[model samples]
Target: MDNHFVPKLTRRALLISTPFVLAGCTTASRETVVTKPIVPAEYLAMYDAVDGEPYPVDAADLTRVDPAFLRREVAYNTPEPTGTIVVDTQARYLYLVGENGMALRYGIGVGKAGLEFSGEALVQYKRQWPRWTPTQDMIAREPERYGPLASGMEPGPLNPLGPRALYLFKNGVDTLYRIHGTTEDWTIGKAVSSGCIRLLNQDIIDLYRRVPPKTRVIVLQGPASGYGV
Candidate 1:
């Protein structure tokens, strides 16, 4: 299945998976803990209310969310061309490669299902406020929750797909994987979705506007290599 083939990251894997920083010296009594980065004031505008959509998108409340999970631009070294999307599953970060050795990175929430789909794929198409239908497997796992919407769930703020969806395909066939948005902003850096890669609603809308159909997307496999950014 050429469309389903999973490609591995050869040289870029280490650089993409490495953490930006891991501070704190170890001591017997005090355990080393990674500190959260401070969120910049400009984020207020970045996550501000989005208008003119099918539905109202309120400004995201980031006070309780992790600063690391907030969207930011950072230095990125990748052989892949600019405009390529590199998703580091292990680090829960998705990098949208940009010019001049930098990328716009977003924190993602990956679920067990997301772990199953890895490798290179293309953004076959994108939809704004796309409808969502639970897979047969998903229905079987939780009939009560998904059975009512077996046909499909309409797009809305409450919809699992949030406000946008980027469908992944291999060899011109649908992979049934998606990079979508979620209303649950707290899940940005966690592994708790049913299977899709989820970003905050605001982030997804931003991403949807940046890339178009046929964009290249690479989902990295395996654990992170403890290298510093």
Candidate 2:
């Protein structure tokens, strides 16, 4: 080969090998470096879930707030406080009266017009993370919507009933209506549920801890006029 051709060929070979050399250097540097932050053992333990597994909640989603929101307090009151709890289906408000002009005001989600009801009732019983059994009507109307979970939907963070449920009863009969928590927080101030009253998980959990069994529950349209006689 000619001298000039030899030099050009050598230069071409070196250029082709440059990328491989740089990649090797980077790999070696990464192996020798200790750049990642170390988490303390105590802090790592705190991050574990209740079941001793890694908690799945996204850290960015956590928020700090006043603890008072977790408690049951009478905020809005009425002069008549002697009847069952009255939920205004149209207005999406729940009223729990107290003595001396005090009531607990809770935001709620009500059923649509054709699905709502106005009547006297009581909270017959309650459940935590209640199992969802779709009614026959619901299955018939939208089999595709519920076919997968036909037997029943298990309780979890994704449950439609977020954390608690209060089953309503009228004259020793279950009305099949519920005042329960919802996974959809955006629906709290709307009429979007089938026929159940939906509350925020935090709110219902707070309410569940406060109310006792067999507490009177009444669902009404618009606003309640007179107290129960």
Candidate 3:
């Protein structure tokens, strides 16, 4: 008797099995899959707030709130007691008066009372990350302070006004004082500006979007009712 035994096999079975082995080898040699990086949802939300535009790295950097930070507690909702802004230079507060004698109060940084004005004005123009040009008087008063930029300071984080600015006008002439954002949040409730009203960057950004061009603005020397916070 022969020690070896022969087994029958189909040609088709051998052909089908050969290709599967080859397929395994081919698949192993193929490139790995790659995916594009996705931006975070918080960043997307911030982008949407700014008209869905990506932050301009070269233009200016605005102070951004940390998405994780807890918002400050307010006794009332913002856009509070909505009326109009009444800047009281004497009290160092801007009141947003609401109905029924209710008011939303916000601390403000005001200019020296002597240098400030009181009257009705309107928002004639607005700018984003506006340029800072020191007036001739500003240069003369503090040459060392502004000597670095004889021409003017271009838009940037360091600029006195952080991000947005609203130009106030009376009749048809510019008042030369602006309601704008400030890098110095600590200055709120104090007199530190040169006849301009300053708000925190975040606060001003919120206000800028709400107010339209030609909105009535009144600067009052004394406190007034119907102010909005």
Candidate 4:
């Protein structure tokens, strides 16, 4: 059956197949089947807390999140070494390779248009409850929107960067992109970010604690290019 035609996935369905099918993905390491871990209480609490000053607690709506976007396990047929991170942007999913042909998959929000990242990088560092600093380009495009943030916004639930950030680096240089948490849980499974990949604040907090610095990250453009470990 066509991936597009695939029906809505249950938690169980995700373990069996992927809606965004991987065709001709490059396999480099060992085989592993991916699966989901249990959602923790602390991860869920951040969404309920009123972190941002004016943003209502209600704005951190978890109801809008697609069930499939939640973290879960799935059958990942990849060659990338166990513990590598493979991001299928086109599919809006991130995978952490595991042993014995398995992986832990999470639904994700990708960057808009030309902002999608493709290639090998490393998680050089991580920050908890990070501040938000809008880039100069963001300020130039909409000074009214980002000019005040030139000095950086304090970390909070309202901050677009959410609860944690995993900085991505390439060849010893910053990629200016990150895998971070967002208050906008609804954005998962969509392409609506400046240039960073966003996850539910709860989810990022979960992944942040799991992924270590220097972890290999492989971002595939689309299925046509195949995936790596």
Which TM-score value belongs to model 1?
0.79
Q: Rank the candidates by TM-score, best first.
A: 1, 4, 2, 3
lDDT of 2 at 108: 83
lDDT of each: 0.78, 0.59, 0.57, 0.73
Q: Candidate 3 — which residues are off by over 4 angstroms?
A: 1-83, 96-104, 224-229
lDDT tens readout by residue for model 2, 1-229? 1211111112222111111111212254547633333333332332222342121221110012111221133444344444336686765777665444445556688887787757878778888778887777678878999777779887777777666898888889878788897656567678898789987665676467556667777677755555321
Cα displacement (Å) at residue 104, model 3: 4.5
User: What is the C-alpha lDDT profile of model 1 across 1-229, one tens digit per residue?
Assistant: 1333322333343123222333444557766664554445567667788989988788887755677777767787777787788888778889888767777788898877434578899999889999999988889989999999999988888889989999999999888889998878788888888777999888898778778788899888664343114
The root-mean-square deviation over C-alpha atoms between each candidate and the true structure, in angstroms, is: 8.6, 25.1, 25.7, 14.2
TM-score computed on alpha carbons, candidate 2: 0.65
Runs with alpha carbons beyond 4 Å of true place in candidate 4: 1-60, 224-229
Clashes of each: 1, 2, 8, 20
Better of 3 and 4 by TM-score: 4
Report the C-alpha displacement of residue 166, candidate 2, in angstroms.
0.4
Winner on lDDT between 1 and 4 is: 1
Query: What lDDT score is found at residue 140 in candidate 2?
Result: 82
Worst 10 residues of 3 by lDDT: 13-22
Best-matching candidate per lDDT: 1
